[model samples]
Target chain A: MSLAATAATATAAAERGFLSPTGVEITFVLVGLVTLGAAMVTVTTRQLVHAALWLVMALGGLAVEYLLLTAEFIAWVQVLIYIGSVVVLLLFGLMLTKAPIGRSPDADSGNRPVALAVALAAAAALVWVVVDAFRTTWIGLDGPAQGSTEVSGRFLFRNWVLPFEALSVLLLAALVGAIALSRKNGGAAKNGGAAKVDRTAKVDSAADEDSGTPGASGKEQR
Target chain B: MHLAYPAVLAALLFCTGLYGVLARRNAILVLMSVELMLNAVNLNLVAFDVWIRDTLHAGQALTLFVIAIAAAEIGIGLAIVLMVYRNRGSSDVDRLRDTAERAEPDAPAAEKAEVIA
Candidate 1:
């Protein structure tokens, strides 16, 4: 390519926010910072439900980053699945458990020095590997053209049908497993007779309700 | 022969997420860390798909599948954890060390003390 043509290509890349241009560069930097901050909070938070919410922020930041890169479909999937479904399921679990809304002494570990050392070692190794692998290449902002839904749909049905079917079967098995696990067999065995079972069931059910309902204190904070 | 900006960012995100997975003990926090790692992988796949200019768009298509699987995994994992907590009253990682810890006759009187220690 000629010098002028190369310069024009660079300008176009910069305009698209993929390069270090003035207008779009700041946006990418800000988004990256926000994403990192949210991720840090997600890991560090003591409250399980609050951590899940922070995860929503982190995932949403990722989706925003995807949109900036012009991958609209992936961004929407991130929001729909991560924010809409996954985090909600997590909250449902937290609510069902007897974990107190206030701090749980069991939430943190005493052996943090070991965990931190392992984590730091893992992070350092990964950074080194990544830097070594992608040191010289400069990828441009222009992306592929075949990212529309139709193309993806066709590929899913035609080439990758078996793995897709397997995933469905896995989901069904998980549903059955969840039902079996939560069936209250222990309470039934403890009762041995019907009336005792009924009383025990009531007590268990009351506990469940007390935990599941967010309560007045929680509602006020929210 | 060059790494794209998205690919580099994805690598960083994934590595940090991996560290979180290794470090976090809370089951819910572990799930969130796993989600972060998945998102990082998704970013790399999408970036590479765009850079290569392939006709199939395989990377983007696979990312959609990854999102679906992640949702199911989190749902089922949390449900299991909740059930476990209902049975045992706690989700602490070290609680698994003793088989008789939750509701067993073999549990000692000082089991709680031992757990705390």
Candidate 2:
């Protein structure tokens, strides 16, 4: 090509700036906003169960944001693990602890102003740092998708197989630990079998009271 | 497509989780807040992975590991919290401050008297 033709093409390409906002970018921003709102609600709600449900909304919005970013695999994983499993686990914790179904007085400490101030300060600092660091960077959507499952799976197995396997072991340990911690050992006693029977009877009465009045029994113990 | 957008969103989410951790009294709520923070970190990883155009996808791989770790953490944390509630009848963080028992005001004097006797 001639020098003038080469210069013309370079100028045209330069004019097509990478940071130009498009429909996808607009949608991304909108979804991010919704996710932020949901997250805020998740943390601020007084009802523990409602907070868990709002967490689902926040996580779902994040999954949508991931999809918009062309990360389909991570998005689905977010759905399956976060929305499906994690939230359910949280709900189970709430139920197992007999947490109050309505507004919980203990949900918020008397430090809202302080917490809000700290949160705002930290958020501002983080936003400033990230924006300054990546002021003009953009991802090209025309290339091969970077977050496909096959590519991620290959990358994970090739370079990160050790950590992946270690994570499974950690999960197994956590399962064992959870069961051990939550089990009611009615038969183990320091003072022999008679003491064990007494302890079991007391525990059974407490359980009956808890069943009759849910969280009220816990409150009375205080 | 701007990296800053997702990065800033993640930051905001993180700060919200921080506030929840610091200000909430319920251990379960605190655990939920921790999940929020982890999700924020995941968002940051994915955002950077896309921006860097990393062929190896190291960022996403780390994010997967993080998710697995988070699941494990929640499992154990909830178990401990449930155990605490079962024993104490309440999961309030403020109420679980009996880790170190305080000496009674008269304990030292009583001990000295016993020794002298």
**Candidates' C-alpha lDDT:** 0.65, 0.78
lDDT string for model 2 (A99-125, tens) is 889887668876778988999899899
Alpha-carbon shift of residue B23 in model 1 (angstroms): 3.3
Question: Which candidate number has the best DockQ?
Answer: 2
Over 4 Å off in model 1, which ranges? Answer: A1-26, A143-146, A184-222, B1-4, B99-113
Candidate 2 wrong stretches, greater than 4 Å: A1-20, A184-222, B100-117
Q: Itemize residue pairs with steric clashes in candidate 2.
A: none
lDDT of 1 at B35: 87
Which tens-of-lDDT digit does each residue in A1-222 have in candidate 1? Answer: 345544554455444433334433456557867887888777777777777778888889888877766567778878888889888877777676545676555565655566667667766776677766654433455544345456566776777788778877877787777666555333422222332334333432434543433243245444
lDDT of 2: 0.78
